[model samples]
Target: MSLVVSPSKVFRVAEVILEGGIAFAPTDTIYGLLANALDRRAVERLFAIRRPSGRPFLLLIPQEDWIEELGLIIGPRQRKLLSLGITLVIPKRTSVPLYLTRGRKSLAVRLPSSTAGFIRDLLKVVGVPLVAPSANPEGLKPATSVKEGMAYFGRRVNIYVDAGKIVGKPSTIVRLIGYRSVRLVREGNVPFREVLRFLSS
Candidate 1:
């Protein structure tokens, strides 16, 4: 069953995950069901919930600076492209499971401006990266509330943090093509205009 919780409850949710369960959580954008990225069983359960064949999930991290740990950061031009607020999928050399990577030899990673500190601390304590995607089925609009998350996953998830409403848009997604160039993959909260301004300067 789903229960609305508070930031203080993050510790409780972390406890549940330590026991090998999953959680539907609130982020800046939408609700996401998160699991230990390296846990095979957890990953399987996540895929089972979505029931997708090949769609890949994005890995949320606490900081963008950590990109070096996974893969090389794109060059200035690519970084400029990312400044446009697009999500970038890049190659990584991490211990994250191949399944989590979807056998793609890379991972889509992002450091959300919201909840980054909280999630980062939690992951540090858990000793693993958290894998999170929109808490909805493939091709469906993402859920923005605890109620919506529960309605989507029901008892499949262990807990839901009711942090109130979320921004309706998904995160902007871009992929690094080279050191100085990046491709816009998906546009969401981070506007392309703002991104261009940031990268240009």
Candidate 2:
């Protein structure tokens, strides 16, 4: 049976995720299915549940330094865009696992926004980055509430961290082309124009 937790019980949520358990919880952008990114078995379990169609899931890091650790070069522009809650797609270091990158040359990664205090605390307590894909099967809308999450994942997921209804859209995804510009991968909650303006400034 899966456990349902309130936003206040983050320590318990951390425990489950650290044990290679999958948790459906609220992210900075939308509700996501989270597991330890470093654990291959845990990541496989997340894939089993998500059943992504050859697309890789995004990783959420607690700090900017982790960008380099994950084999991506982080520059001033990358730092600025990430701080504004943008997801970055950059060339993957050969060391990144095939499961995480899905054999792609690049991987998408995000740092939780300061506003997502619950998720930030959860990552801090878990002490590692998490593979966070939106809470839904492929081709379906992401769950905004725990009940909707339950409907999609049922007891397959280990923990459900409810933060009420999360109506927020997914994070804006982008790829940096040069020092001066970025390519929009997907338009989500963040405006592409705003990202361009931030880079241009």
Candidate 3:
């Protein structure tokens, strides 16, 4: 049986994730299925649960520093874009496992905004980066509430951290081309034009 709890229960939530258990919780964007990024078994379980499309799952890092820790080099533009809550797909680093990236040449990553206190706290407590894909099975809409999350995952998910209805689109994703340019991939909550404007500024 899945345990449904509010975001206030951060310790319990961290316990589940640290123990290689998956959690259904609200993220900086939409609800996501979260697991320890470095735990291969845990990530395999998350893959089984999500039955995802071939595309790689985006990871959530507590801060920009984690980018290099994961073997990804962060440039100034990459830094600026991440600060705007955009997801970036950079050339893959060896540290990122093939299982997580699904054999892709690049990996998508995000540093959650400071406004996302629950996620920030959870990351700090868990003490590791997390693989966070929208909390939905392939071909289904993301759950906006714990009820919907529970309905979709049930006992498969260890905990459902309810923050409330998070009915928002996922973050905008862009591919970093070289030292200074970026190619828009998928535009989500952040507008592509705005991303361009920010880059220009």
**Clash counts for the predictions, in order:** 10, 0, 0
- Write the residue-wise lDDT of candidate 2 on 1-201 in tens digits: 999989899999999998989999988888999999999999998898897576788999988888878887556765688788789887767887798898898888888888888888888888788999989999899899999999999999999998898898788999876554679999997899998898877
Tens digits of per-residue lDDT, candidate 1, 1-201, equal: 555677567678788777777888765466788887667788788888874776667776545555665554456555444323246787666564578777776678766554354555566566555778878888787888777877788888987777777766778876766565556777788876666556657
Candidate 3 lDDT by residue in tens digits, 116-175: 878889988988899999999999888898999888999999999989888888999999
**Per-candidate TM vs. native?**
0.82, 0.95, 0.94
- The parts of candidate 2 lying over 4 Å away from their true place are none
Deviation from native of the Cα of residue 22 in model 2, angstroms:
0.2
Instruction: Please give the CA lDDT of all the candidate structures.
Output: 0.69, 0.87, 0.87
Instruction: Predict model 2's lDDT versus the native.
Output: 0.87
Model 3 misplaced regions, further than 4 Å: 52-54
Deviation (Å) of 4 in candidate 3 = 0.9
Q: How many backbone clashes can be found in candidate 3?
A: 0
List clashing residue pairs in candidate 1. Answer: 75-179, 77-180, 78-180, 78-181, 83-195, 84-195, 87-172, 87-173, 87-174, 88-174
